[model samples]
Target: MSEAVLETRDLNKNFGALQVSRNINFRLDAGARHALIGPNGAGKTTFVNLLTGVLSPTDGAVLLNGRDITHMRQDRRVKAGIARTFQINTLFAGLTVLENLYLAVSEHLGRAGAMFRPAGARREVVDEAMAALDGLRLADDAGKTIRELPYGRQRLVEIAIALALKPKVLLLDEPAAGVPSAESHLILDVIEALPEDIAVLIIEHDMDVVFRFAREITVLVQGGILASGPPDEIAANAEVRSVYLGEGTHD
Candidate 1:
């Protein structure tokens, strides 16, 4: 197997006496389509936080391409090729879709200071932003403000922003959460169409999405991994079914 683009070594996290992640050794290889699923309070969010440098692990290390980045700052992590989207919408609600993506693209290029200039003046940034939107099939909505788009489209915009950063590892937190059933498929379609070279890890409660999008699934329960394998094995794992899937619990 190839070396993991991202990894955790005996990862652990705690809040005083409560342990949220324990000895969580994990890996995301290049071009991996993986899912991290668990019930509520299963430490899924905490684990992602630790990986993104949003929260520090009590004891352990985070590695990117075999280099230790356990204490790296969040923004630095992004520059180092790790980018993520949140469970909730984090876009500039009042900004047009193009504007929001432009900001991210510019920041990723270390040209954020040039954003004060007219959009046409920064042709490269705008082109890259447009490319991301076009890939997600959101180019038609570019002129609309995020607040004006439907909830589902808003989620797509968040993804577009993440892609504009040109990450090697893309961490998606509940990409379809709160989306109507009728529109959730749109998110799935986009996910399935992501760049083949970028390792994508999705944290989601929706079983259908999880099963369909993940080539490999890891079940996190009580701050630990209960199972990790292909989708068929995960679905058949009694422990995972009992603790998460079978219970029909939301994370």
Candidate 2:
């Protein structure tokens, strides 16, 4: 069988006396779209940190393509093909959409030698950035500063930035946290249409998008793995229903 692109075995974390993540086991194959979901305080964010090296796990291992990277630094993890998007949008506020993407592409390509050039003059870099923008349907806004775009479009650009990194694993924390329903749908479409080479692990509170996009769902409660499987199976599990879904509802 092909090796897992990313996996965590018995991963644990603590803050003072509080156990934020407890023996959480997760695995994602190449090209898998795995969704992590739970009610508030379920430790999903903590788990994302563990995988991305933002917060070191108090115990256990994180293996990327079968190599131990449990304690690697955050920047090292990004260099190792692990890229993430924050819940809040992060972008180059004063730069145009094309310029924002150009930086991302340049950062990944390690092209610091050309940083001084006018963004438009770097024909090859600009072309790649424009292509990425076009892929995300933001090509028309390429010339506009990020601040000029709507909240939703800015969010798309954030994902595009991560995509420019050419990650093998993409950890997204609440990609649609505060957008309007209509814009959220657009974000979902952008997410679903991501290139097949990247493995997407998303933490979302929106059950509608979770059920629609996830092929596999992992549920957490109080920092522990409560259940994980296909969405239909998890949605039907009695314990999950009682702990998360409340009484008498199959949603």
Candidate 3:
């Protein structure tokens, strides 16, 4: 088998006395699209935090492509090819869409230090920013401030920022949350079109999107993995039914 693009070895985390993630042994190969799902407080978010360095694990290690990166800083993780979007929208609400993309391009280009540099001086950056917007079919809105866009458009901006990083492994924390049913189709399309070379791990509650996009599913319950496999297997797991599905409908 190919090496895992991302792996967690016996990962564990705690919030005070409550263990929120326990022995999160998992791996994603390059090009895999994986989904993580469970009821609220199941420790899904906590597990992602450990992987991304937002929260250190109480025990265990996070490995990126065969290298240990458990203690790496968040920025270092980003530079190492891990990029993520938040559950809530994260963007420069006051800036135009192109300007927001410019910031992302700047981060990728190592120009974040040159605050005095004119945004117009970077032709390559501008070109890349435009290309990213075009790929998302948001080229027409490039000049509009994020706050002026619809809520769904603003969410797309956040994703565009992460895409600018050229991530080898992308972590999307609930990209469909709070989006209108109509607008969610846009988000789903964008996700479906992401580069096939990149591994995608998504933590989302929307079963429709999860089942539609993810090739494999991992279910967590109270800080532990209850079941994992293709969606069909996960849905039929008795433990998953008793702990998570619990009378909820399934596709």
Top candidate by TM-score: 3
- Give TM per candidate: 0.95, 0.91, 0.95
Candidate 3 similarity to native, TM-score: 0.95
Q: Judge candidate 1 against the unseen true structure and give its global Cα lDDT, from 0 to 1.
A: 0.92
Model 1, range 40-72, lDDT digits (tens) per residue? Answer: 999998998999999999999999999999999
lDDT of each: 0.92, 0.87, 0.89
lDDT of 3 by residue, 1-251 (tens): 66699999999998899899999899988998899999998988788788889999989999998999999999999999999998888788899999999988888988877878786697888999998898888899999999999999888888888898899999999998889998999999999999999999999888788889999899988898888899989878888887777746643
Question: For residue 187, what is the lDDT in candidate 3?
Answer: 94
| Residue 81 local lDDT, model 2 | 98
lDDT of 2 by residue, 161-219 (tens): 88878799999889998788778888999898888888899998877888999988998
How high is the lDDT of residue 6 in model 3? 98
Off by over 4 Å in 3: none
> Ranking by lDDT, best first?
1, 3, 2
Q: Could you tell me the TM-score of candidate 1?
A: 0.95
lDDT of 1 at 229: 93
Q: What is the lDDT of candidate 2?
A: 0.87
